[model samples]
Target: MEVYSYRSDQLAASPKEVFQIVNDDEQLKKIFTILKDIEYSTKGKRSKGAKFRITLGVRNKTYRFRNEITEYVENEKIVMKTKLKQGVITTLFSVEPKGAGSELSVQSSIESSMGVRMFIMTVKPVVKSVMNKEMKKFEAAVISEN
Candidate 1:
């Protein structure tokens, strides 16, 4: 298993506010730069059993992955899992109220076969670096909105 994690510096919004913005597809699209495209299989609100396909462009290569919401807790936690050619990716998002603002953190876990271990390990730092930048971008967007 390979893990990558990041915590936001601090946002001028509540935990619920941050969670809502991150969960909103439109808001996320405005904040995240690496997402090339996203399509939802359903037209319902954000909840468990929702299915979506995300197209990510990284290092000049495009990868499409299907994501299903495995677990969700409003203003608290979200867990999503995806099975890709390289591995099984599981991502967790947690939000907590802090000082007059809020803090949001994301943890990603990748599980792959034996041979891909080295490749995955080498890519971990890159993933963390991107997440760190994205986290800052997200926080800034959320803070500026208020």
Candidate 2:
């Protein structure tokens, strides 16, 4: 398993506000440039075990995947899991109050075959750059909400 993590700078928002933005589909699409679209399968309120389909446009190719919320902690954290042909991917999004603001973090674990692992190794730097930018954008969006 290969893991990549990212943390955002403290934003001028509370933990509850950050959590809400991360879980909101429209907010996600607006902040994450690569996120093309999200289709929720779980009706009504979202909670543990909720499922959604995400289509991401990356490097000119569109990849679609189904993700399930495996863990949920209101105003604190959310963990999502996705199964691919090669392996499974798990992502955790967490927030904590820092000073008068909040900090957001993301940890993603990829368990895949050797070929995919090699590809990930090659593109890890680029991914990190993109994730950093996304986090910055997220912070900005959260600040704008205040």
Candidate 3:
């Protein structure tokens, strides 16, 4: 498995507020610019073991995947491990309040099958760039929400 991440140095909202926004699929969908749609397969608020399917539009192509929240910590962190057509991707988000702003970070662990390992190398950069862009969009949306 290969892990990749991005952290932001700006203050948007409080960690608690950010957590609320991220925990709800509807709020999260509004913040994701590239998201086509996201549906929670399970009922109730987002908690550990919640499952969701997400479709993201990127580079003129749409990629769909299903994920489950394996870990959830209020105002602090979330870890979602998704099953893709080619591999298992684990994504983590962490938030910390700083002096005048909060620090937000996202990490992804890509566990590829032997057959898809070679393809991962070629797509890693693209994935990183896309993740960066998406996080930025999410940040801006949350900030504007307050």
Candidate 4:
């Protein structure tokens, strides 16, 4: 299993506000250009066990992953797991109240299939960079909304 984590801080926003921004599908479309499409499969709103089909570009290669929300603690954390063609990926979003704002952290891990471990090793750096860039974009979007 290979792990990569990125942390970004945005000021003057409550945990609820941050969670709303991140959980909103329409808002997400505006924040990340790499995401081509997202279809959520839960009733009225977001909740644990809600499934989504996420189409994103990774390393210039478009991939679609089906992610299921494994855990959702309002204003605190969200955990999602996906099984990609190359591996299994888990993403955790954590929000902590800081002063009058909040600090958000994303921790993700990717475990490649035995046969494709070499490919994952070779592309680890690029993957990490992409993840960092995405997180920065998310932070900027959240901060601007405040």
Best by TM-score: 1
The candidate, 1 or 3, that scores higher on TM-score is 1
Tens-digit per-residue lDDT, 1-146, candidate 4: 66677765654688998988977888887788778899777763467888888898766789888998889898899888988777778989899998889888888777657666776678778878877787778877887887
As for candidate 3, its clashing pairs are none
Q: List the residue pairs that clash in candidate 1.
A: none
- Per-candidate TM vs. native? 0.89, 0.88, 0.85, 0.85
Per-candidate clash tally: 0, 0, 0, 0
Whole-model Cα lDDT per candidate? 0.81, 0.82, 0.81, 0.80
Off by over 4 Å in 2: none
- Tens-digit per-residue lDDT, 36-143, candidate 2: 998888883357988988998777888899899998899999888987765678998888889998777889888767877886788678778877888888888888
State the lDDT of candidate 1 residue by residue for 50-122, as single tens digits: 7889998787888899998888888888888887777778999888888998777888888766756876788
Clashing residue pairs, backbone N/CA/C < 3 A, model 4:
none
Which stretches of candidate 3 lie above 4 Å from their native place?
112-114
Return the candidate ranking by lDDT, descending: 2, 1, 3, 4
Best by lDDT: 2
Q: On a 0 to 1 TM-score scale, where does candidate 4 land against the true structure?
A: 0.85
For model 3, how does the per-residue alpha-carbon lDDT over 59-90 read when each residue is reduced to its tens digit?
89998899999988889998889897777888
- For TM-score, candidate 2 versus 4, the one ahead is 2
